[model samples]
Every structure is written in structure tokens, then in C-alpha cells.
Target: MIERELVIVGGGPSGMAAAIAARENGVKDILLLERDQYLGGILNQCVHTGFGLEYFKEVLTGPEYADRFIKKIRGLPDIEISLRSFAVGMTGDKVVTFLKPGRMERVKARAIIMATGCREKTREMVHIAGTRPSGIFSAGFAQKLINIEGLLPGKEVVIVGSGDIGLIMARRFVLEGAKVSGVVEIQGQSRGLVRNIVQCIEDFDIPIYFNHKISRIYGRDRVEALDAVRVDENFNEISGTKFALKCDTILMSVGLIPENELIEMAGVAIDRKTNSPVSEELNKTSVPGIFVCGNSFKVYDIVDSVTRDSLAAGKLAAEYLGRARA
Candidate 1:
């Protein structure tokens, strides 16, 4: 088993920032563990620009901004990063179970910080009536495929949500030679930023159907068609508004849920709106020495907020460590 003075779980923006902040704040022997091959979690796969406007004072893509922190991480002598390590479970008393190489080991730390990020809620959670088909996909899944894997998800598609991911995918697929017929939203107002609506969907001339949902899917082997309809008050169906959208692909951009399984295990009080650990100003979780920040805290409308929150959490975590020792 390995040991360290402090361990930060999940090597995303928050975790990376936490490590840097902790070390700079005078904490030594810091270790950042990630389950992915690369240091940046989820950010590496996001290829589109619009990140780092506030924190860096420059417009950058996800990877580019993440690279900025990655560079900083390498410069710190007190920080050690473990790639391809799964933070499987943490015991109630703060013993962390993680897998490295072929062995499962437990690592103990005086202070623990959870920077585990959020993940997309898939089609199954949407509860829409549909046959299990091959062509169906989540917007984030499609983005990962085309952006990172260099694979095309489909040539003709109908998106089922108007979240930023869906709206962004609408433009992404169109640019990749896919015909993105339309984007559907369950609410009258889009769940995404105003800029995304104007840039991703409206700029591409892709129609966004408001207050509509996929009532059913018509496909046997692959998604061949979709039945979209409008909704009224209480989300009831609006009569005589059903229309069969002819498309070979259907993308679900339903919603996002914070990946806080580890946080849940820690028994920290979580915010219902975020499904992540609740924090007032310091990004400290209900559990002391266990903090959470970034998208896992709340779905920030701006990446600037994410970075700012991380910086705050990291600094606060360092202070918490000192206080605990005192």
C-alpha cells in the first residue's frame, strides 16, 4: 500500500487545483489519483472552445485549459499523480480502497478531498418509450466518439434535448458531415446557456422544438424514426401535435447528474439540486477534511466559476488541514 500526507480523489480540474493549492499552501506529500490514462478527467475529450475565458483571460478548449493546469502540476515537487488508479471505496473512518496494477490496496491519509466530477444521465433515466436500438446515443457519448476517438456516431440524427451538450453536438455533428435535423427541449426555455442557443443551434439553422419530447421510438435494429410531440401544463401531451421525425439517429441529451458515489459513501450532506456535496463559501463538504468543488458542486453556467470554485476549495482544504492538525 502507498501512503501520503494528503490524497485528492479524481484528477479533474477540481482535484488538480486542489493538489496545487494544497501544496502551495504549505502542505507536503500530496498525491492526486485518477482512473483515466491522462491527468485531465473528462476535459481532454471536450474539444470545443469556450473554456478559460475568466480564469486564464483567454478563450480555450477543454483540453487546452486542462493542459494549463497539467503544466502546473508537473512543476510541483511535492505533488505525485497516479494515473489509471480507481478510487473504489473509502471506509467510514477514511481508509480509501483503490486499485493499482493488479492489486487492490487501501491508502490512508490524514486529509481527503473529493474532486470527482459529474457525468451525463443517459436515456434509460429519461424514461422515454423506446426500443433498445444501436443508433441511440447520449450527446456526451457522441462528442467523446467524434472528438476523442475520431469516430463518427451517425450521418443523420435527431437530438432529443437542448442542453449545452446536445446543442453543441448539433453543431459538432453538422460540421462532421452529419445531418442534425432538430433539437428537442422539454422546457420552453433552454437548459443551456444563451450563447449556446445562438451559436450552436440557431447559427447552424437547426430547429429546436420547445416543450416537446420523444413520445416513442420506431426502430427494430437501429433507430429509424421518432415520434415527437408537444406538451402542455404538467407535461401532459398536447393533442394533435404529434409528428413523426424521419431520421436514422437519435441523440439523448437528457440531463446531468453529479458523479458523487464516493461522496455519498463518505456520508456528507449533499445538495438536492446538485446531487453533490453542499457547500456554503469554502467548498467544504459537510464532512471536515473532505471537500468537493467544480461541476460536482453545481452545474456552473461558466467554466470560470468552476475554476474559481476549485481554487477556493483547494485553498480552504489546505486551511482545513492546518486547523485539524492544530
Candidate 2:
């Protein structure tokens, strides 16, 4: 068992920012844990620019944005980083048990911050009627496949959501020499940013079928074709509006859910509306000594907002430790 004044459960944008903020605010003992082998979280896989525009006033890629913070985090003393670590269990009194390398370790902290990020919605979550196929993937998975692994997911792609990831991936597929048949949205309006809609879909001349959905998918072993249908305002498929889109791949980017299983286990009060922890202050959760920030609090449209929110969380966490000591 290890004892620390503060323990951050994630090493993404929020976690890194929180640790830095806490250290600057006089929190001496801090430990940051990440499940990935490195820090930066999902930002590492995001290769696109348009990040840090609001925060840094410069156009940058996701890695570039993360690197800026990581550099600062590395320079801070008394802040330890543990990679390839996962918080598997938590006690009622704020003790966290984690798995790292070949051993299980426990850390008791005066304050804890959860910046666990979010998870992409999958085909199973949407219940898309289709034979189990190989070419189907979440937009995040496809992004990681292309950016990190240097591999294209497929030649022809049909995106099933108009959210940011799906929209961004539509352009990525085109840039990578893959044909994006269309971007389909079940809702009438796009759920993504206006710039993404214009740059990713409209700019590429990729068809966007609003009030439409992929009703069914067809393939034996891999994706061959999919059935697209126009839906009414009520989201019911209209008669005689079904069409076939021939594509080798389907990317699902319907939604993102906050990763808060451990927080829930710790008996934190959750906001029913956001499905995230109920935060009264900038990042203070209902559970005292346990702060929630970033996507774990509520999904932010931009990374700049995440950093701002997490900076406050870190400061508050430091204050919490200070009060405890006083």
C-alpha cells in the first residue's frame, strides 16, 4: 500500500491538467495513473488539426495539444506518473486499489480526481440489425487503426452517425484514398460542429442523408452493402424510402458515455441528465475529496474546455488537501 496526498486516476487532458494545477496550488504529494503505456489518453490517436485554437491561439494537432501540457506536467516536481495502471477498486473512505504491471497496488489519498474520459457507442448499443460482420467498427477504433497503426479500415465506408467522430472520419477516409459513400444521420440536424459538417462532409461532396438511418446491413463474412431508409420526425422509417448503399465498411459514432463505473461504485451522486457525476462547483462532485472533471463530469465539445475545467478541479483538490491538513 502506498500513501499520497493526491491521486489522479487518469492521465488524459483532464488528469494531467488537474495534477499540474494541484501541484502549483501547493499540493506536494501527487500520483497520476494511466492505463495506457503513456499519458495524453485518446489525444494521441487523434491526428487531425483544429485543436488548441481557443486555448493556445494556434492551430495544432491532438498530439501537439497534448504535448504542450505533457511538457509542463513533466517539469513539475513531487508529481509521480504511473503508466499501464488501472484503478480496479475503491474503498468507501477514498482508498483506490489498482492493477499495474504484474502486481496489485493500493493507494490511499486525501483527494482523488477521476478524469477517466469517455467510451464510444458501438453497433451493439444501437442494435443495428445485421449479420455479425468484420468490417464494422466504432469511429474511434477506425481512427486509431488509421492514425496509430497506419492501416486503412476499408476502401468504401458508410458512416452511421453525424456526430463529430463520424463526420471527421468521413473526411479521413476520403483523404486516405477510401471512398466515403455517405454520412447518414437519424436526426434531421447534424450533431457535430458546423465546421466539421462543412469541412468533412460538404467539402468532400459526401452525401449527407438527414432524417435517415442504416436500417439493415448485408454481408456473409464481411460488409458488402447496407440498407438506408428515410425516417420521419418520429424516427420511424417511411414507406418506400429504403435505399441500398454499397460499402465495405460501417463506422458507428452515435454517442459517447462517460466512464464512471468506479465513481458510481464509490457512491457518488450522478446527474441523470448528463449521466455523469453531479458537480456543484467547477469540478467538485457530491462526494467530498473525490473530484470529477473532463468527460467524466460532462462531455465537452472541445478539448480547451476540458483543460479549463480540469485546472479548476486540480486547484480545488489542492485546497481540499490544505483544509484537511489545517
Candidate 3:
């Protein structure tokens, strides 16, 4: 029956940054909860060096970028970090239910930070007509499997989104010795950056198909091939435009949605647009003391931006507890 001044749900860049800011601004009895065995979220699997260009003015790997906040919090006494703890449920009664190693615990907090990040849109969401293959993976999930677990998702791959993550994985899979058949996009213009298109696709001689989509996936136990077809302005398939590619893997990087299941359970009003708890400029949710930030608030393009947004949430949460937050 312990109580906390503030409880931050997540341990990614935003949650870590918020806890650090709250501690620095004189908040006490603050707790940070993470579901994974470690602190960083998706950043733990991103080994490439492109993050932190704006915040730190230097290129850093994703893990390195997350480390910048995590290391600082290690020295703070006001913050308690709960690793392997999942913040499962939230209620309007100001109670949070979480599970640790073996036991479930409940804690009441004066204020809460919902910093859970983003979720990848899957093949079902994209409506890709394909066999249920084992090799198909979301780009981020593939990144985790490849980089974190040191496993190769497939030997040959066809990427189905010219997104930042999908394109990046094109390079990553190549560097890992997988042959990239091509990158295909349903949109006329790519959803990724120009630099990524140049570096990951063009430089590698991996062909890119615009105004195209994966219409079907064919295989038995594992993916053996896939069909890419051109779509009309109305998204209806253009006849006689189907092309098949031989590959064992299909990587999808369609879109990101904010994670807000718990935010909804808390009886907080969420924006259908951001898919996050709706808040004003002060970042306060419809519920009196609940707040949200980072990708949980909106699908931001950069982690550095998420960190800055978290600082605002931390300040506002502190202010609610009678601490004059900056």
C-alpha cells in the first residue's frame, strides 16, 4: 500500500527523461516502471548511428542515445526504477496495477506519466494477401531479432514499405548478408527520408517500386515468393500489372500507432487523431492528474523530440504536486 508522488509508465527515452527532469526539479518519491528486463525500449535493438543529431548535435546509435538519459538517472536518489515490471492496468481511482517478477503490486500516485511508445502496424492492418509465413516481420521486430538476438530474419528479402525503418532494415539486412530483392511502396512518393532512400536503396542498388503494393504472399511452411502490383488512384488493383519476386522474407513498415490501451482504461479522454490521451498545452489529460508524452502522445519522427516533450510533462506533473516545476 505504498504511495508515490509520481509514477512514470515506461522506461524509454521519454519516460527516463521525464523522471530525470522531475527529480532535478525537486520531486520526491517518483517511480519509473519498465516492462522489459532493461531500461530502453525499441532503442535497445537499434544499433545504427543516426539518432541524436538535433538533441546532442552528434550522431549516436539508438542504444547510445537511450543511455544518455538512463546513465544520468542511475545517480538520482529520488527515482526508483522497476525493471521487469509491467504496468498492466489503470483506473480512475488513482490506482495502478503492476506485475513484478512473481508478485502483483498496487500503488497510488498523485500524478502519472503515460510515456508508452508506439506500436507497429502489422500485415493484417495492411491487408497484405499472403500466406502466414514465418519469415515476415515488421521492420522494427526484424531489427530486434537481427540486432538484439543476433538472428537473421531471412536470407533474401522484399521490403514492403519505403519507410525509415523498412528502408533502414534494407541496409541492415544487406549488411547482415541478406539479399534485398527490392523496396516497394503503395504511395507515389516515398514515406521515408531522401537520405535514407539514397543511402539504403540507391547506393545498394536495391530497386524501389512506387505506386505499388504487395497483393499476395505465396509459400508453404516458409515464404517462397510474393506478388507486387500497381494500384490506381482509387487504390484498386490495375489489371495485368502483377509482378512476382522470389524471396524468403517480407518486411513491413507501414505506420506507427501510439500505444494508449492503459490511457483509455484510466477513463482519460484520448484524441482519435493522436491516439494518445488528449491534453492541452499544459499536457494534462482529461483526468485530473494523468499525463502523456512522447510517441504515446503522438507518432514523432525523432527520439530527441520525444525527450524534449517529456521534459514538459515532468514539469507539469511536478507542479501538480505543489512543486513549482520549470
Candidate 4:
């Protein structure tokens, strides 16, 4: 078992920001663990612009924003980052067990930050009746495929949920020579920001159907088409409003849920509404030495908020360590 003054459970924007903040605030011996092969987290796959406006006073892409902080963290000699490290569980007394490339290791930390981030809800989670086909992709997954892997998800796409990711992907699909049929939302209005709606869907001449949802998907091995139906406020399908849309892909941007299995294992109290750790202090969790911020605390719409929230968490965690030593 390795002992550290601070252990951050993620290496994304929140984890990186927290480690930087804690170090600057006088804490040393910081260790950051990331499950992915890289340290940038989801930002590495987000290629479009519009990030870093609030934090950097300039517009940038997701990777650019994450890089700004990543470079800073790299220069900190006291911060240790472990890539491809999957945190399996945590003890109530603040010991964390993680699996690395060749071996599993445990770390006892004076203070812990849960910045494990969030995961997108898939087709199964939304209960859409459909053949389990190959053309379905979550908005984020599709983005990663195109941006990181240089692969196209489909030639024709129907995006469900008008959230920011869905809107962004609609434009991305169009840019990639794919035909976007339209974006469907079950709500009465679009859930994404007005700018994204205009810049991505509206500006691209893509239609957005409010109060509509995919009723069924038809295909044997891959997606060939799907049925969309208008729904009432109660989310019941309105009779005779179903329409068939020809598309090879269906991307769901329904919602995101915080990855909190480790939080639960540590016996941290979670907020039922947000499905994340309950904040007891400024950025501290119900567990005295445990803190949570960014998407792990709540699903944030933007990366800037993640960084700001993490800075507070890091500072508060440092204060906690100080008090413990005193």
C-alpha cells in the first residue's frame, strides 16, 4: 500500500484542476489516477470549439482547454499521475484499491477527491424498442469515433434528444458528409443552449421535432430505419403521429449519469436527485476527508464549470488536510 497526502480518483478536467489547486495551496504528495490511457479525459475526444471562454477568456476546443491545464500539471514535480489505472473500490477509512497495467495497488490518502466524471445513457437505458443493431451510438461515443478514431458512425443519422451533444453531433455528421434527418426531443422544447441550437441544427437547416421520440427501430444487423412518434406532455405517444425515418444511425443524447460506484463503496452519502455525492461543505462530501466536484458532483453542461468546481474542491481538500494535521 502506498500512502499519499492527496489522491484524486480521476484524470479529467476536474481531477487535473483539483491536483493543481491543491498543490498551489501548499499540499504535496498528490497522486492522480486515470482509467484511460491518457490524462485529458473526455475532453480529448471533444474536438469542436466553444470551450474555455469563461475560464481562459478565449474560445477553444475541448482538447485545447484540457491541454492548457494538463501542461501546467505536468510541470508540478510533486504531482504524480498514473494512466490506465482503474480504481476498483475504496474503503470507508480512505484507502483506495486500483488496478494498473501489471498489478493492483492500494493507496491510503489523507484526503480523496472523487472526480470520476459521468457516463452517457445508452439506448437500453431509454427503453426504445429496437433491434440490437450496429448503427446505434451515444452522442459522445460517436464524437469519439469521428474525432479520435477517424471513423464515420453512419451515412444517415437521426439524433434523439436535443441536448448539446446531440446538436453538436448533428452538425458534425453533416460536416463529415453524412445526412442528418433531424433531431428528436421528447420535451416540449429543446434542452440545449440557444447558441448550439442555432449554430448546429438551425444554421445547418436540420429540423428539430419537439415532443417527439423514436418509437421503434427496424433492422436485422444494422440500422435501416426507425419510427418517430409525437408524444403528449405525459410522454404518451399521440395516436397516428408515428412517422418512419430512413437512417442508418440513431444517436441518443438522453442524459448523463455520474460514475459513482467508488463513491458508494467509500460509504459517501449520495444525493438521490443528482445521483452523486452529497456536498456537505463547500466542496467536501458527507465523508469528512472525501470531496467531490465537477460531473462527479453533478452533470455540468460545460467544461469551464468543471474546472471551477474542481478548483474549489482541491482548495477545500487542502484545508481539510491542514486541519487534520493541526
Give the per-residue lDDT digits (tens) of candidate 4, residues 1-326: 78999999999999999999999888889999999998899999888899999999999998999899889999998999999999998988999999998999999998899898898999998899978888999999999999999999899999999889999999999999999999999999888889999999988999889999999999999999999999998999999999999999999999999888887888988887678877755567778988888888888888998899899888888888883232
**What are the lDDT scores of the predictions, listed in order?**
0.83, 0.91, 0.89, 0.90
lDDT of 3: 0.89
TM-score to true structure, per model: 0.95, 0.96, 0.96, 0.96
Q: Write the per-residue lDDT of candidate 3 for residues 169-251, one digit (tens) a residue.
A: 99999988999999989999889888889888888999999999999999989999999999998878999999999999999
The TM-score of candidate 3 is: 0.96
TM-score of 2: 0.96
User: 96-135, model 1: which lDDT tens digit per residue?
Assistant: 8888889887888777877877788878887889787889
Tens digits of lDDT, candidate 2, 1-326:
68999999999999999999999889999999999998999899988988888889999999999999999999999999999999998765889999998999999988899999999889998877978888999999999999999999999999999899899999999999999999889998899999999999999999999999988999999999999999998999899999999999999989998988887888888876567987767787778999988998888889999998899889889888873232
RMSD of each: 1.9, 1.7, 1.4, 1.6
Off-target runs (Cα >4 Å) in candidate 2 are: 323-326
Better model by lDDT: candidate 2 vs candidate 3: 2
